[model samples]
Target chain A: MTEQLVIMVLLSFLVVIAFGIILLKDLLVAVILSGIYSLTAAAIFVVMDAVDVAFTEAAVGAGVSTIFLLGALTLTRRQQKQQKHNNYFALLVVTLTGALLIYGTLDLPGYGDGQSIANQHPQLAQHFLQKSEDEIGIPNVVTSVLASYRGYDTLGETVVVFTAAIGVLSLLGLRRRKREEDPELDAKRQCRQQNEEV
Target chain B: MKYLALYNYWIVVIIMMAGFYIMIARHNLVKKIIGLGLFQTGIFYFYVSLGKVDGGTAPIFVESLEAQATVYSNPLPHVLILTAIVVGVATMAMGLALIVRIYEKYDSIEEDEIKAIERQHWQENNGEFGISLTAPPTASS
Candidate 1:
């Protein structure tokens, strides 16, 4: 019972954080608020007995990503250049989607309800609980899923990474090796030159 | 309280959508990356949330330490997401690396500024040089 009360409070706090992210005008503050939202979600995961997820949320969502964003932002400017205009048609589409989502949720099972499709599936989930050791030889079901069942897919993903690296290498040769042959560089030089003239 | 768990999925969905919206709608490149980060985290949370078992405890299992083996939650999600977090970190690192290159190319990191600069660059070079000159220098090799 106490858990329920505590969770409700935290959830409200999360909603507030989300709204804060949305409402903030400053881009830096918005990013920071987004971190708060991730932390709040982590806490909520802990409340729901998802400590692993909470750890990931705290580490990746809050820690590493924050640093990455800050680094990226250093190379960029903050202030939004063009103001976004409100269009009623876009609003209606968003609203209708939200309404439909709410309506769909009406049929969902109650929170943490034991009889959820997640829990009910014996062959899928219960098997993990029962025979995870003998069959897959791994205690962690997620590992079994990611490493074995979908291992090939992850390998393919790594290949995609390699492909991207090659693409970048071929497109942007090293500075000393091959000077930027791009006429765009010339144009930027021209722009800089023009700016200097002004 | 059970109802809240059911609704938690909605929170994940909302976070994901908000992140997606920010990534797409916002003109700022850094904000777009942040949006991408948010959106990725939302999916991570969703996957992690799916493994929660009611009345469960943490999964600190040791071969020598099964004495406290209560109804512990699944360890798989934690382990899986651990890898995911590492991958995400690596990906974000690579993204920032790309942003560094973007900064070098465009001079101005602001998306709108970069766009303007690129457009202006295209017009200036295209009118003056055309294909008579070599391809413009992209980040590629």
Candidate 2:
């Protein structure tokens, strides 16, 4: 019971942090707030007993991505430019989509219900739980399923990561190879040009 | 009581919407990428919440002869989400790279300013605001 209460409080705090990220004007502050938001969400995941997910969220969402975003921030303006007109259309679209999602949630099984279709079904999940220990001889069902049962899917995900890495490298090429082709150098030249024009 | 039973999923829905709102309303390219990360995390939370079983523990096994009857949380969603988190980070890196390039060429990362600059260049070159699919033959051609 106390665990549930703690989860509820943490979940509410997460909602507040998400709102803070959306409403804050200073882009640098917003980036930092987004990192905090990831850490808080990871805490909530830990309370829910999703320790592995929490670990990934801490390492990827909070640690690496925050550093990547900060590095990107140095290349752009610190503040977001204000628009002349309000984004009413965007607000309307988001509201309608959110309402639809809430309406769709009405039919979902109750939280943590053991008899839910996903849990009660004796197909893939059951096979993993029952046979994983004997077949794969691994105690951690998630590790067995990820590394053995869904090995192909994991391979595809790894490939996707590799492709994304290649794309980023091509866009923001290596610094030592061609300093003249680098955009950071181009940005410096443009800055000097602007000063001369002024 | 029924609402309490499903409060977890509702929280997931609300967080998902907040992320969507940020992705749509924010003009900053980096913030949009951050919103994308939030949206993906909300999705992970939803799946992980659904996988939870009442009175169940984490899926790791204990060494005992009587370990057969232990109820463990579903591990499928955790595996899927583990893969997803890695992919999300990689995608965000790609997005930030593109944003850097956009900032370099346009001299601004503001969406409106970039659009205005493109429009001015288009008018100057094509003599109108639309693309010219049919090319006028050049001297070499």
Candidate 3:
């Protein structure tokens, strides 16, 4: 009961933060609030027995992503520009989507029902939990499943991360090459000015 | 009790829609990326919630399994979501890098302003291919 109450409070905080992120014009504050949002979500994850996920959310979502946003902010404007026209179309679209999703959830198993299909699926979740000790020899099912059973997925995820790093480096690296070329451009400009004077 | 059971899903829907609305309605590129992060997190929440069992513990194995039967929350979703969280951060980083490059090119990070600048360039160039090639790179405005 206490656990549910705590989760309820944290989830409420998440809603409030979501509203804050939407309504606030200051990007820096929004970024900080997003970190708080991730931390709150992490807390909820912990309550839901998702400790590993909570760890990753706290580290990656709250830590690295916040730093990335802050680094980007140094390069871009902090204030969101005010537009003349209201976005009623966006509001309507969001409302419609939310209503549809909520209606769909009515058919889903109740929260934390142990016999839910996802929990009892013999081939997938059950197979991992029951056989991971014998096949993978790892007590932590998530790690075994991630590193052994789903090795290809983890490999692909690593490749994706590496590609993103390379993409970011190449995208931001253009400035350094342009900087190296500046002396030549400056010298050429000086020659043009001198020739004009002559 | 029926409605209460679906509370988590309802919250997830709200958060996802908030992110979706921010992504589409906001002009700021950074804000849009933040919205994208929120949207991804909402999905993560849904998966994790699905894996939850009323009385189950985390998926780690116990020392004495034969002593007492234990219920472990589904580990598959946790594994999937772990990979997803990493991918999410990578996407955010890539998006921010693109935003920086866009700012450097057009001197603005707002989507509508960037579009307006591009349109102006298109009109000035009259459908030519060398739009950015002709204009000297300007310092940050």
Candidate 4:
């Protein structure tokens, strides 16, 4: 009962933060609100017994992403432009889609049901829980599953991260080089060009 | 009580839709990226919620394994969502980088203004081409 009450409070906080993110015109405040949202979600994850996920959420979602956004803000405008008109079409579409999703959830297994298919699936979750100690010799099932069972997927994910880093470097690195060029060197190059023209 | 059982899922849906709305309706590129982050977090919440089991604890095994049977919540979703969270951050970084470049090119991040500029450029080029083709046709006629 207490657990449910705690979760309820956190989830309500999440909902309120989401609304804040949507309605706030100041981009900076919106970004900070998003960080709070991530932290609140992390707390809920902890209450739900996903401590590892909660840790990662706190680190990446609340920490790195917020910093990345603040850095991006330094390069872009801080205030969103006033929209000329309300986007009724988008509102309608979002409402309909949300309604359909809510309808789909009507038949889902109740929260924390131990007999749910996902929890009892023999081949996937159960296999990991049962055999991870013997096969991988790792007590932590998540580590064994992530490193030994899903090693290739993690490798692919690493590759994806590497590629993203390279992409960001290539995209923003050129401007940094141009901005950092020495003024004396620029003048020297111009002088050389003028001498050549004469 | 039955209806309350699915409360977590309902909230997840609401959060996800809020992000979706922001992504589609907001003109600011940074806000759109933030929305994308929120949407990803909501999906993460859904997955983590699915992995929960009543009376279960975290997936880490204890030192004394023989004393009592321990029920650990499903670890698969944690693994999957861990990978997803990292990947989502990567995607956000890439999106932000693209936004930075777009701002550099267009001097504005708002989608409507950029579209208007592009439309003006298209009209200018099309008008030149149409004038040349119609001039020849009218002279021949």
TM-scores, chain A, per candidate:
0.73, 0.86, 0.87, 0.87
Better of 2 and 3 by DockQ: 3
Highest-scoring model, DockQ: 3
Provide the TM-score for each candidate, comma-separated. Answer: 0.70, 0.88, 0.90, 0.88
lDDT of 4 at A179: 24
DockQ by candidate, in order = 0.32, 0.46, 0.53, 0.37
CA lDDT, candidate 3, residue B15:
95
Model 2 chain A is weakest, by summed lDDT over 10 consecutive residues, at A176-185
Task: Give the per-residue lDDT digits (tens) of candidate 3, residues A1-198.
Answer: 777788888998999999999999999999999999999989999999989999999999999999999999987778887666879999999999999999999999988888989999999999998999999998889999999999999999999999999999988874543333333334333433443354
Q: Which ten residues in a row have the lowest lDDT in candidate 3 chain B?
A: B132-141
Candidate 4 C-alpha error for residue A177, in Å: 6.2
TM-score of 2: 0.88
Q: Which digits, one per residue and each the tens of the lDDT, describe model 4 over residues A50-153?
A: 88888889999899999999988988679997787899999999999999999999999888888999999999999998888889998888889889999999
lDDT of 2 by residue, A99-157 (tens): 88878888888778878888767876677877899999988888888899999999999
- Candidate 3 — which pairs collide? none
* Per-model lDDT: 0.61, 0.79, 0.86, 0.84
Cα lDDT of model 2 by residue, B44-127, tens digit = 888988888888878777788244688877888889999999989998999999898777655666665555655654666665
What digit string (tens of lDDT, one per residue) describes model 4 on residues B1-141?
Answer: 878989999999999999999999998899999999988988998898889898888998898854789888999999999999999999999999888766654456777665554554457566432112112223411
Off by over 4 Å in 3: A174-198, B64-66, B133-141
The runs of at least 3 residues in candidate 4 whose Cα sits more than 4 Å from the true structure, single-residue gaps closed, are A174-198, B64-66, B127-141
Once model 1 is optimally superposed onto the true structure by TM-score, how far is the C-alpha of residue B95 displaced, in angstroms?
Answer: 3.8
* Model 1 Cα shift for residue A11 (angstroms): 3.3
**What TM value does model 3 have?**
0.90
